[model samples]
Target: MKHLLYLFMLALPVVATAQKDSLAGAVQATRPLPLYRPGFALMLSAGSTGGGVAVGYSVSRSVAVRVGANLFNYDGTLKSGKDTDDIQIGFDYTVKLKNADLMVDLYPFKRSGFRLTGGAYYNINTVTFFGKPTKDVKFNDTVFTIDEVGTLDGKANFNKVAPYVGLGFGNPYTRKRLKFMVDIGFFYQQSPLVTFRTTGMLEPSSDQGSVIQKNLEPLKYYPVVNLGLSYKL
Candidate 1:
């Protein structure tokens, strides 16, 4: 009995060491591992920046790049009086906004869903102010030609390449296949070039293009807000 009791006591340390090593291995196996595969995503968005679809490619787990196109249009009428005559003139206006862009997003926190974005946008936008006399203007008791009465036609050109900055939510890829996103940003662009043209007596008014340009000074900056959904591929 004494011999058996001594042998059991001597084996205790060996058994305890084996159990400790087994527990350590189990804990190490449960830690999350980084995925090394590349991924892609498709997104649809809408807001002041316009509505469009974008495609993204993952450069790495926390970085991505994308490209997209967007468009918007507006139509309306405007009225003004001729400088030399008391007759009123009317014009039909068409405003168009178009955009093409490339952007990069950086996800700084692996555990959080926030990102910072920067990009460049090329805008092909124009505003046309135009109208013709529906009926001949009775000026000084005589009717006038579009040239004599003056055609109210002018175009404002906003051909610009601008820089953008913004903040957003969502990863280029997620643990699951789908994710929700939100972005708010601004585009920095300068004032546009304007041209005014006419025929007949009012042709001299073309020189007033500078005055027209000043009236449109408030339209230089563009605001953007977007809500989007993305699917991984």
Candidate 2:
């Protein structure tokens, strides 16, 4: 009996070593595992400084769609005079765009059960602009006045829609409680409905509140940047 007890003790370490080896092998095998799930995501994006958010739903492994909105504002100084401290040029332009997009993911990489995806996308965007500003301006030979503040007011406002396409990248959804990603892309399109409302501080005030300076200019096709994130359910 004493001899058998010694043999069992000697075999215990061998068994433990084998179990450890098996566990390590299993971990290494799952190093590249793909994740699959039917899910949805909430995305927020900022590009060239513009900002927005989107909501998307994944119907299959390679296809999904989303819709979203964006808005931004900028301010600066244009010029000033000797008596004047600083003639600030504030561009209070607000851009509102409603968008719908279709996603196609091709490049795929899996690590630690997470699947990463990259592909191309097409989006249709409707953009609108609302511009309002206030400034102090001097006439050809007259001194600037406090009432010039309202006189300097102007606006460029209109709405239009366009279509564009670009590359997109993100993580594929897994059958998990939560998932997230970021997307950046380029777009080419045109906006035809942009109109400018001008005030006559440099000239004279008309009976009408404001006047359209010129016909709306079409926003030509150009590259755009986007970023976003999402959650899975």
Q: Considering every candidate listed, which one attains the maximal TM-score?
A: 1
After superposing candidate 1, which stretches have Cα over 4 Å from the reference? Answer: 1-38, 79-89, 132-148
Residue clash pairs of candidate 2 = 155-197, 187-224, 189-221
CA error at residue 180 for candidate 2, angstroms? 9.5
Candidate 2 C-alpha lDDT tens digits along 1-233 = 99999999999999999999999999998776446666677767776425766676776665566666665554433322244443333433333333444444443443332233333223333333332223455556666554554333344432333444455556536544444454544444443433334453433433323222332233344345655555654
What TM-score does structure 2 among the candidates reach? 0.48
lDDT of each: 0.78, 0.48
Report clash pairs, candidate 1.
91-131, 92-130
Per-residue CA lDDT of candidate 1, range 1-233, in tens?
Answer: 99999999999999999999999999898865443335778988887767878998989767889998888788997666654555566778887878888999998887666899999889887888975554456666787665566576789987479788999997747565677889888877678799878766667677878877887766677777888888888
lDDT of 2: 0.48
